[model samples]
Target: MGFWDWLTGRDTPPPAPVPEVDPAPTEGDILASLDGVDQLISGGALPAVVRSRAARVTRLVRQTLPRLGSLGLGSYDSYSVVATATDYLPEAIGAYLRLPRDWADSRPVENGKTPLLLLIDQLDLLGATMEKIYDAANSTDAAALITHGKFLQERFGHSPAADLNVPTPPSGNSPDPFDLERP
Candidate 1:
């Protein structure tokens, strides 16, 4: 090392880089963690409502997961969404399950929701995400797809102007699609 560099303390080597790791857990890992959460809640002295909520979380997770797998979420892109469900689902339920009964129900957090409410909301959001993922994955189902299409057709397929089969008046102004043409 040069004398000036050593004296100035400018020759220090950079620290070794930390290894990169996947942020999200696998579906199997999440399921396993959820089993732990289930056991904890089931064995706890928590109130019946808390126990029921935890049970519901487990039920939805179990129901959504296999369908997710069947929907071919094998790649990283598709599976990334599944990661949040696995991670947060257990954390929310487990947090409520682990907290003391009084604290979970009575103690208020900053957002006006008690710890229990927060947990329930998180679980609900997770359930909705799972449902959305399931719907997207199952889009290949022709009957269901057709059913949805038919519903949209009945509700919004025909505009007022189109329903009357009237030709739109020629105008210089921007045409309002909602403005029905007078026959």
Candidate 2:
């Protein structure tokens, strides 16, 4: 039925039009490239190189936090604006830092550090995993992972250390997805 007809109660509203957005590439497609690389790392399903890169990136961002905070306006809101405008560097770093050691081996192997390297690597793997999940139809597991990544990407993507001008908690009354640890 046409919209005009439905509006006049002549017929029920036609089904809502499906969005035209293109589906993102699948996880299987990217996983095919990673192959057994994930298994080689401490996390047993994340890439080590990606972890190293994420740690290095986070370290650099952490160094800039002080300078960024000191910029003009010097308010939390200003910090958020500047941070979000930059790039996803901060988020990548935050995700690396927030990763549970248990998931990637709590003990550090090199430089007397815990296996943070492995954890960071897992974040990179997670980015790839997100790309796949975004492409596929909704699954409980996939939804959970995507929700986690989205929060990390949105919250820490700009400046993980910078305080946002929102309430005590970023999203008021919003349930936290990360609170549920993936086992």
Candidate 3:
């Protein structure tokens, strides 16, 4: 509405909006922690089994992070992923790493289970827990897909033959005249 702008019939653009500070850790922040854990674990000289389980848990967390909102903010599942990235997973691995490898691997600290075995158990538990969270987080999308499919089916119509991939003869195709089974 300025005089020059009005005369020119051109409008001035509005100012850019400021981004609000989010309270929750963003994807980047979470990923950074996960990356840190990866570096820590990978840098240490650990057995393949340990590395595998840790990788599994980390992968689960990474996969689950995107759909985390589906699990709800401030929820236990969300917190678990965060904690695994930031604390639980790192701490367990770090504690094992701090101990002398040969001693830790050889000696039985708890009920005849070596530190390596205990670490594997912890990782397995974490991996399972992460899998549960990942499933829960992704269940929303699955539910949505099912709901959408149902809606489409209801709004249109179900095609059992098509759904089952069964084939039908083309229209206007002539049947074998010699066939006695022809209708």
What TM-score, over all chains together, does every model reach? 0.52, 0.21, 0.74
Deviation from native of the Cα of residue 56 in model 1, angstroms: 3.3
**Number of the top lDDT candidate:** 3
TM-score of 2: 0.21
| lDDT (C-alpha) at residue 112 in model 2 | 58
Q: What's the lDDT for candidate 2?
A: 0.46
Residue-level lDDT tens digits of model 2 in 38-150:
22333543345664554443333333333433333445433332332233434444455466647545666666555556445545554453333323323444678889988
Query: Which residue runs of candidate 1 sit more than 4 Å off their true CA positions?
Result: 1-18, 22-27, 69-81, 143-183
Would you list the clashing residue pairs of candidate 1?
none
Off by over 4 Å in 3: 1-24, 160-183
lDDT of each: 0.67, 0.46, 0.89
Candidate 2 residue runs with Cα over 4 Å from true position:
1-44, 73-183
lDDT of 3 by residue, 42-147 (tens): 8858888999999999999989888878999899889989888888998999899989999999999999999999999999999999999999998898999999
Q: After superposition, how far is residue 32 of candidate 3 from its true place, in Å?
A: 1.9
